[model samples]
Target chain A: MRSTCLLLCASSSASGGGMEALRVFAAAVIVVGFGLLATTAVFSRLQRNRFVAALIAGGLPAVATGWAIGPGGLNVVDDSTVLLLRPLLVACLGWVGVIVGMQLRASLLATVPPLLWRWALTDSVLSAAIAGTGAAAVLSWWFLPGSFGIETALVPTTLVACAAMGWSPETRSMRVVLTPSTQQMAMLIQGASGIAAAVAVAVLGVAAQLIRLQPDGTPVLDLRTAVVDLALTAATAAALGVAARHLLGLARRKRGALLVVFLGTVAAAAGIAVDLGFSPLLLPLLCGVMIANFGRERLASFELFIMRAEHVVALLLGLLAGVLLTPRIGLPGTGLVVAILAARILVKPVLARRTLGPVTHGDANRSPLRFAPLRQSQLSYVLAVSVVLAYDAPLTRTVLTAIVFAGAASDAVPLILGFRRHREVAQERRSVAGAEA
Target chain B: MGERTDMRLLVLIARSEAAFDPLVTGLLDVGISGATVVESRGLAAVLRQDLPIFAGLAAFLPQTTGSRVVISLCGADRLEALRAYVAELPPGDRPLAIALPVDSFFGLEPTS
Candidate 1:
């Protein structure tokens, strides 16, 4: 491990610094490994109980654990340590992107109820619009005119909007739900969340390419460059996907061998994407989409393997987010959070009533899925962290902090509402039974 | 030894993967050394596969079925013993077993 670390440092001689820096890097890797292991052990123990398992599935607890040990709290995961783990974090992000992308099996999706797609599209557009406009206003007012260009603000705002477009897909923790009554709604939420996550990641990846920061942190808009980069990345991702699929076949359906193929593919794609100023989330996502849509039967077990690791990857990213978060939710940050919350709380339900109502046969008050939209999508964290990585700015950290807070808060909304719904449901059942008696 | 009419094809559908071990042990103890175990899934597993990754943990839950089907050819005495063994197992761990009469069979080595 030391030799490999040294080699990695040696290969990048320009920024390798010296012995002390290498020591810090090694320490960071050890710290992060131990942190993840300890966190996993605790989480695994807690998840044995179905109820606790559901709660942990939402991902805030992992984030909180990360935050607790992070520099802001305990100084265990300091900034320098996080900087050293950049490549690993990028790979983790790619892992998540692949999971999201793998859900895009066209054949499978075609069989889904049309209501899911409609809900996903509606939520994506409205959430993005609400988040983008509100964030733009806050950001515009927050930044001085001469400090930065509109493109700088535009990129983060767009990414934030993209982050706001989905809800948590976790249904196991929702114990209050009567499965028979809410099964369709739960499935709809899960399916739409996947679609919304795909849209958000893709849009965030594309929007990220539109702006490039110079050595001095000046944001430059280069449309031709963005388009060319995007096209190249997409082509490269497709090639990688084909190669990965072929390699997976050669793996002889062994889980260990399949895992190696996945890791190598994600690492290569993420490295290339990061090197080319593209969102590392896009390439592996495209690769996953390719893998899912083609040669699917052969790779079914592989898909299962990836899905099995999804929560672990998600929690890892959440932990990284916690480590990377600066908790500097300034005035603009506060406003942005409020904007996102208002949109999720107010706009989302009304939109659901207007669009999903007809098909669902119930509006917000009548629908079992009423609170489903309130929980922020876990993919939002992935996007926010990607932005933090792309731009190491105070503003980006604030965005991440706001997202974390919003996600946690949004998660609570569903629990409270679901409990009330559960009680009301029991009461109604008893009343009906009494009348029948 | 009894005639071929005494043979029975026993099919045990273990409700979970964990149930196969004791079942196989019991089958072996009942003098049935040959059996085929095939991995199987319940309808819930199929539906769970359609869920997004967030709820994919359903695949790992203890309650979720990872069923296996065990098929074997045995004599009436061994089949009864296997059935008795299965009946002795805890209700939750016991697999559903069915015995079909076998008219003819081959590939058996007669003991010297």
Candidate 2:
């Protein structure tokens, strides 16, 4: 027994040495990512250009890591690492959704339904078809190859199609950066995105059902369950809205109490979601919408608190995405990247121009709704897809990381340029108006 | 107070151009003139500083820099005319306008 123990210790020590080194490396990456993010935050605050800050803080580290380790850099952290972080990620997402939900409520009231709704429908259809088709083509060529026959491709394609509805929080981010004046446009875009996402989610659920077959060829995610789930999600959202209204009334009387209530309600909802096997994102979004649209005036004023929390969560999510990138998943084929970029930049803009042409012209004098074009949305979609893809192919974790990195990069450049342009135009207009007067 | 006459005053507070054009025009249409305007900043506005130089010194200094305050004093008989004018002004939360009674005024012209 003593001899056996000695042998076990020797072998364990050898493995420990290698594991310890990897752990240190992972820790270093996390620290560096956080440091960069902190720097970006500080710089952003000083400069008052949050878009620039987001790019620097969230984008730079992800790109550097992706370049160094290739697509699979996140693999170094191991599956166990992701497993541990998953709950935290879910919690963070929940909090973010809540905050967004609150904001959405406020924005919805200000929206002119017919025009905004029309834009949303158009964007959703175009984005989904383009993104889904692109993802399907890329994944088929690279991962599936000859593995999928036409029948099998349907499920994966559906998954990819639904995934195509992904959009970045860029519009929301822009709202934060350009406040008061641009609020109307921001609210419209947010409303459009929310509607589009809902539609896409519905498509995804349908697709999931279509593809879900047993070993002998039966169905999973039965239609009844899907319907029930949908109903429940809607009901939950309504309940959340009612609750927020009551909470807001309470909050008005005792200012700080809302924070505690907000946290508690979210925690309970998250728990319920986990138990019920619901789309965790939907309920919180509903809650946010309800609060923003229907809650008391005082609750609307407490939006700053929710926004602050969203920023922190978004930062953390970006950092985690960075750490998750591994060489295998990170190394997206150049063709695929180009295709994704093209779909977002070229195809999306064209579609947007075509669909929103009438609205654009009519509202030329009024504020233009600034949807964070396909490029930004594509990055967010890619990140979400990468994470979803990771469930099946562990190596895809790197791709998710790369998505975060690329998104940070792509989003930063355009946002900074856009912001500068917007600022200049504003200044020019102010001067012109001043001169006119 | 002697006759208990109705009156109106057009009060305006703005940093930019004078927003009292409509009010003034409306008041003129109603056959009222000779208003007394006083400019002062609110306590909150006066306490605000461009740069937070010294937390301690902030209490000593006024809250804001370059704030314009205008109070229009008119005859008590023009209250109806003033209410209509104030209602037409652009609405906002801060830099508000309020109408209060004047018990008596000396050497004021009666509306023609």
Candidate 3:
């Protein structure tokens, strides 16, 4: 009897080891899948078709891919695995924010004409507000029957609004002849104006996240707390940026070591943020912006480091987001969300064209002005998705669904408008030929 | 095209900013992987930086100060191909391309 009991224990231990090995294999597969998914989506944007760009850019495919492999579908990436990997999600987001920070240079803002600033602000802020407020009202009303309140509605509404905002006036596909000075100047003014607006509003959203009210009044003086939060976030970013910059500079000589250091920095930032109550994105973002602006060499090094790792991280986070969205928002609810996204798409471009009208005082026939098409790329999508994951509530998930759709649609907008214009021109030319006959 | 025995450096000064892009594409066509771009001012502008007296003459010049200089190192066999590519730059005032022999390059030494 004693020998038999000892033999049973040994068999159980062997089985346990096998289970552990299986877990390791699954985790590796998921990581690799995420990396490949993200890389594919990133490369897909290089193609000319805006629809394809939008589909991939929305990260919808990645999310769906993740869901297919998650508990909701195949039970591959179980709940425990996702929960364990939360820190990784934060790090991926932080990296995306860093790329965003790099895009918005201090010099770009400094050089922007005051007149152009007026229009860009209108396109970025006002349009976002209109979309957010309208969506918030309708959705909150719809979800009010459930366990939803005004406060609950605010986050999703704000996120969707923010995601759909930012008009990019740059029509990159259109050929511009520089003979006409007025139109050339108009095109140049509208060039980065939309992107600048998007950057400003995104930073504003970060500021919004920092300020929250508690019923107990334990967190007093909202203004003071916001200031403190901003300062802390800035300090964290600066320290990490400076440190990472040094690592990157050294990395130039030792490429392998550089990859290791970059990974360490990302992990460190995410770990620290999770320990504190702060969003992991804030520090890395501020760090990226500060470094990019201050040190040219640092910017170059940072880009090289980021260029290697960003897509992988984004893919990982996007995969996690797919798993996290287990509870479905339902068919009708999703439709309403899609409608809100559509409203934002409709309103923003019209507002953008109108707002910039003051800046563009020239005849369309004489000097055809092409305003930068409202472009929503990695920044808008990444920021909104990060918020959804950070908040991780039913309402936030609903908002995430909408934001991803809108994010994808934004990429396709330029193509959609261009195709329509081409059709219209063809029709007019046919009509002219008929009249001559 | 393959591993090189001798290395040479090609320095190109493009007259137009637009010409620089076509030149780089031309280099890539002939299989040059690495190059550096340095934005530079015209000789008059450089002289103005040295002595402010030439600053007044900026109004007279066409303000063609924006220029791109591209530098790339290539294997000896590829030098003729690069020269041919540079010579094919479009009909306008194009750009100037010069080649120099490199001796004992550090990290840049070809595997062959």
Candidate 4:
């Protein structure tokens, strides 16, 4: 009788905990829905302003809203809530991966300039080296110290480096004021950004698969296991891709069925990656590449449907980042953010000019679009969020914070610098008019 | 190409598909019932599709759906009312209209 009573008591406690968790999860969904709706309404009206649109595109407002309502601020979206929403977050990560990967159509990439690839490769290498060094130094000095080995240090290092590699492709504000020659340069920069995004994620995927963090936070580099996991992920992605293609092809006539198929495919892929300890970003990415290449024109509409939700996915990831943020990035974390900001602002532009200057026949060296390298890519935020989802450690959270702060600050650099030039040009035009009068 | 008549053929090219509903409603409000609407694709879209290199220019172009072409035949008095109604429509919804004298009429219903 006593043993039976104990079992009942334990079961009741478990049930109570589950119910409490459900309540928290439901409340979080409502808050997120409200935030998304509010952001959509405001952005719809304000998107005409290029700067505002850029911010919206970067998911900054969503991030800010998330931060305001999250544990760091209101303690509403707490740790337990985020833990429960992990699957949703994983699905979003997969969505981003697929979207980025679909742009990698072989034919489209064939037309891309060779110089752009060179620039992307060179930029990724250099940024990784610089950011990786800073990450190592900071991690060694303050965060990791003696307990964890170099493998552990390398995880956040890879993250920061990848985050620093790409420049923002949103050059609308710059293009409006650019010469035709400079505008072409902007296009080249934008093309390079697209390539760099793929490179960043690819690098992140390889690094993540190779490094396994032990239960006690000790990172172990297991080459054999990594290879096996990678092979499994690729195979799984290929199978899922083929299945999704067939499903999408069948459901083409019915929009409702098509949407359900797409959602189910993403969830399955994401759930598999999460369950098997695969990089969520990589599995769906490879799947998207398959869909893009093999599915061809039949899947074009499905790809478009997926692309349409890119912004919402980005916003959702931003919200996840905000809720997961610890807001306790220590001195080392602050240093990492400042170091990243400095490197992005100071080093990235010089490197870009030196490397890509010849491609534009030195036009890039003279144009305001030259400042484009200072802005961080929107993909950088996606990269940071993926790391948070995979790890959810204090170290990963700090990296996310650093990347977010650095990216926002870097995005502002070009705009602020251009503002002075714009003002001067306007004044010159006004003076000419006055002189004529 | 024919004798002067009271009928005018109004060919309107609306800027976007979204404007079609309001455009047709306004036409009805002005007492014109019969009209033909045809889907159209803009020149830029054609150029972008035909010339892959021009796809790069898409980023700079303002996003817009291909226009709609609307053709209607009505009496001269109804044409004047149509012009006034279109003028009151929002700038974005306002269609580019070209009215020609319907030199000859075949089968049509006449509203007093």
Candidate 5:
């Protein structure tokens, strides 16, 4: 009896060791796969777009392949892989945010009063209404009906609301969709979207507490505490920005000082945010905005650095998203998927047109303006928000993953069509000018 | 030397043949007529598998886009004309012009 018991313990220990080894091996494979994808992506400059498309196309099938591979697909990977990938994704996002923030700095200051006020009001109201309604509906139907009570629904809804509230305009894509005439219209739409996103996040936090039936029904961190934390984060970023501006001023004659300062500040802001448990995304953006508004000469210098960093980050994030996406887990029910598509494709664009009718007309007749296509960057923001949502509600992770994949697919067609239209318009203009000449 | 003078070489490097017509026509309007256009591949134009090797070979290879390069060598006397001409041609933020001293040349005779 004693010998039998000892034998059993020895066998169990051996099995544990084998399992650990398998996990490490699986992690190694994923790292290798990611590295290859990143390398391929970076090297293929013109082909980068194609490569990304291919990767996304392969994602669903790859998930299916994982499922076919059995227990190794579901259980072989460790938590550490997720941990490693998260920072990389955050860093990439931080870099993009910095670039965006830099671009918006000038506009933020130059924006007219009525426009600014309208934007503030519109964003706050729309973001709150959309996020609140969506959360309520989702919670009532999905969570409340299941084992999850209001408490569980509260956290998820808050997460969704926060995501809904934080919209970053896709400036890069806007250049594609509308001609110069529609730029202001585009900018207005983008501005409103961003404000809405921010307000949504804040309201969601408060609403979550209320729904959770927690004492005070407010964020555990009071308004004062949250404000202080936000201020500290902003202050740190500002100080870095100022330091960068001064260093840049002193080294105005230096060839690469601008690059150094730009990179150093971006990295520092992102790192600090990660360490402090604050939003890494917002800090870089704020820093960018501050620098853009204050440092005119340095702006050009900062742009180059930001672009290089953005490319690196975008590639890394794309690869990670590809690796982590499991189509099986978070596949939204057909109804939900259709609803999301309808909201994004039909409802959102129509609402945007109604809100921005005059501006769109103005854009059509005028010079290549800043903003016309209100829908610009909306897709990317929606995708990013979906990912953020996934982080909070692990169950929806797969669905969000699918959404990103599908969004990418749908986006490609519109982009191509828009590009072709622009080309035709440009050609027509040139011919007319030639005829006159 | 015929004259001790400074001259500018204006080069138009384009990715497509379609771009060549506008660029050349614009240059012509600025009194620039003759230019040496070459075809070469750009760094970004290289294939993915060939990038590492291309980066290594970049030092040895001439800076070419495989697209088209138009080079106009103007005399020192024509500097102002060339500058005005290039300026009017297209708005490329980067400098596409290089000033080099003409030591000697043995090509065509000067126009009357």
Candidate 6:
């Protein structure tokens, strides 16, 4: 590991050495081994205790490690190398999108009751609206200044809001949800809500940004530009979906071909979105869904195959996002971070109870549905990182810092509650059973 | 050779999905590596796990994702060691484990 790091650090001896590539390849092999160990831990201990499980899935350590190596910290990985890794980061998001998209198996989703779907939709809409409004307000205040026009603040506003809207179900696998909802109804609620939350994030990613000035100081971005971005993303993804359909056979049979197809298609979809000034995260996600549903039967194997790769990419994405978190955040940046995290934390449960009040009763009324929105996962992480990478401003720093903190805390809360709730129940039972006797 | 000898099948029914991987890994570390894990939910799983908690909600459902069964066919000589190792694991967290003799076996041997 030391030798590999040294080789990686000594890159560009007058620039462009095959040895540098070789060292990176070597480093990847080591990283993959570590990723495998981490993935094994994730799966092995997944159902252990929800709190410990959360600790296992937590990105706090990865972020800390990233900080240690980051330019702001140890400087082991500097800005230029981080720049070189941008394509890989985008590819990581693409893979995350694919993992999410493949979960939209129509046959599976069809089984979820309409009542739960209504609840899920309501939960997502409420959370997004509340979080978005709060984010927009924050950016309008001390966050965005002369860099963005007051009239055009919607661009950064919606982007910040989009970061807070995603919630993860943290399924043990696609085969089962990790939540204690063993019943069909409960499982359906969990699944539908998770899917609904992801869709909400996707929609937020591509929503209107109104008018903004170009870096050249020429004014650009209008309703027309938004329309064009929407058109280009949809058209590009649709075309790629068709292209992927033909390549699916070769990809399924040949391992090398599989990697090329995914990397190529995702790269193209993401690249096209960037060129068109659209959210690059949405297109590959669409493409992934399209591919998975396009030939539904053969997709399970492909999904599982990509899952092995997904583990590695997930760690890297978390690490890179962590690396971007700097030590410096002025008072304004701190305020913006606090505004987003606090609003999300404050809004989720209150809104959940209000929306779910009509649908449930008894213990179910006291349900977990409201609690989940507080937690954020890869969907939230990828979106926040995408915005930071795209906008490149002080506001982005605030969003990233806040998200890393919020995501870890939010994910821990509900999971820890799962175990704590059980322990409390057992304690209550111990006394109550004797009292009943 | 070891291939010619009859073996015992190590059968473990773990209460939790969390225990499955560790059991497999433990066996593998002791050189009893080849194992098959299957998703199974028996009456005990429904009653003891699902019914008591999920209760009325799961009672009507056709099947729930419950209990996991892990099986590995091992050489007869290794059964005692496997049993000893499993015995060492904490009781509550451990699975319901047993070993059954394989009278006759067929098909291709697992390629390690």
The best candidate by DockQ is 1
lDDT of 4 by residue, A286-337 (tens): 8877776775553444544565566567677777667766667878888788
Q: How displaced is residue A387 in candidate 3, in Å?
A: 2.8
Candidate 3 chain A lDDT trough over 10 residues, lowest sum: A1-10
Which prediction has the highest lDDT against the true structure? 1
Best to worst by TM-score, what's the order?
1, 4, 6, 3, 2, 5
Fnat measured on candidate 4: 0.00
Q: Runs in model 1 with CA error above 4 Å? A: A1-54, A175-177, A296-298, A354-368, A425-437, B1-39, B42-112
Model 3 quality (TM-score): 0.62
Clashing pairs in 3: A168-A372, A168-A373, A168-A374, A168-A375, A169-A371, A169-A372, A169-A373, A170-A372
Tens digit per residue, CA lDDT, model 3, A1-437: 00111101112322336664576468667787657754563453442343443344345666677677777777667545554455566667666556555545665456555655555555556656666666766665675556444444554566666555553332323212224444344344333443443454355446444544343312122556667776776677778877876776666424467667666766666555544445556666566566567655423333443544544665565566566554456763465456545645666557545655555444332232342334443444455555554454455556555555554555555555545655666687899999999
Residues B1-112 of candidate 5: C-alpha lDDT, one tens digit per residue = 2442455545656544444566666666655566777875554333311211101111112223225767666656655654665566434221245666665544653221
Q: Which CAPRI tier for candidate 5?
A: incorrect
lDDT of 6 by residue, A176-290 (tens): 2323432333444345445654575477556532333364433355777767767766677778877986797655435577778878887777766655556666777677667
Model 3 lDDT tens row, B11-111? 88875555667777877787887888888655533222211110111112222344678887777787777677767765533568788877656655352
Q: Taking the tens digit of each residue's C-alpha lDDT, what string does model 1 give over A1-437?
A: 00011102223333546754765665466445644663454645565453464455566877887788787776666555666666777788788877777767777676666766777788889888988888888877774345445677767788779868877776654545444445555556666777788888898888878887665666778889988998998898889888888888787446578889999988888878877778888887898778777675535556656665666677677787887777778777888888788779866777656655554533233544666767787778878888777776777878888888888777776777666776787898899999999
Candidate that would win on TM-score:
1
- Alpha-carbon lDDT, every model: 0.70, 0.47, 0.53, 0.69, 0.45, 0.57
Fraction of the reference Cα-Cα interface contacts (below 8 Å) that each candidate reproduces: 0.10, 0.00, 0.00, 0.00, 0.01, 0.00
Query: In model 4 chain A, where is the ten-residue run with the lowest total lDDT?
Result: A1-10
Candidate 1 structure, TM-score to reference: 0.76
Backbone clash count, each prediction separately: 0, 34, 8, 0, 26, 0
TM-score of 2: 0.57
Per-candidate interface DockQ score = 0.12, 0.03, 0.04, 0.06, 0.04, 0.04
